[model samples]
Target: MNEQTKKQYTMAVLNLLQPKIASLVKEAHPVYQEDLEQELKLKMLEKMQTPFLHNIPSFFEFVSSNEKK
Candidate 1:
């Protein structure tokens, strides 16, 4: 992808993660929230960059399932 498209894709993923990120922050201890948030962002970006798509879950779906636990 071009630089602009890559950035747009990243931002789109980030936007989709906002609500889940907020939920995770509230669910986590305040002291660890920043670290957890950063980790989640890294994970989301990593998942986005991967080319394979055989059994991968949608980002929000994964977040929702995690939220349930």
Candidate 2:
């Protein structure tokens, strides 16, 4: 299969499997409720932007490479 066709097929399979996988995860991990909530909170905090941020050249370089491709 071509690259585009393979990508489409993979996305279709992931869409079909996502709900089933989520259900299984929920059933199997009924014990990590507090940990999950804490982890989610940490992720939210990490994503917050502060006013005193410095410019990172490496991050900009990575983004430029992706845009070129």
Candidate 3:
């Protein structure tokens, strides 16, 4: 897909998945649930702002590089 479409799809998937993830996290930890959700939302927004087109590496490459770091 084109860059715009890719970004939109990425966001759509994140939107769909985030609530389920947040729910699970909240269920696991009853305290500070709202804070966790807010923190996760902010982090997601920060990650989404970084374009994934030019600098994104393969999954294995990313994992290995992070391991090295």
Name the lDDT of candidate 1.
0.86
Q: Lowest lDDT 10-mer window, candidate 2? A: 47-56
TM-score of 2: 0.39
Taking every candidate in turn, the Cα RMSD to the unseen true structure, in Å, is 10.8, 11.9, 7.1
TM-scores of all predicted structures: 0.68, 0.39, 0.45
Model 2 lDDT per residue over 1-69, tens place: 477875586567556755655555565566875565456445534543233332435788989988999
Predicted candidate 3 versus true structure: per-residue lDDT over 1-69, tens digit per residue: 598997797679678978686776767567778777777777776776676754789899999999998
| Per-residue alpha-carbon lDDT of candidate 1 for residues 1-69, written as tens digits (9 for 90 to 100) | 598988897898799879989897889999999999989999888887777843578899999999999
Error of 2 at 36 (Å): 12
Steric clash pairs (candidate 2): none
The deviation in Å at residue 6 for candidate 3 is 11
lDDT values for all models: 0.86, 0.57, 0.76
The local distance difference test score of model 2 is: 0.57
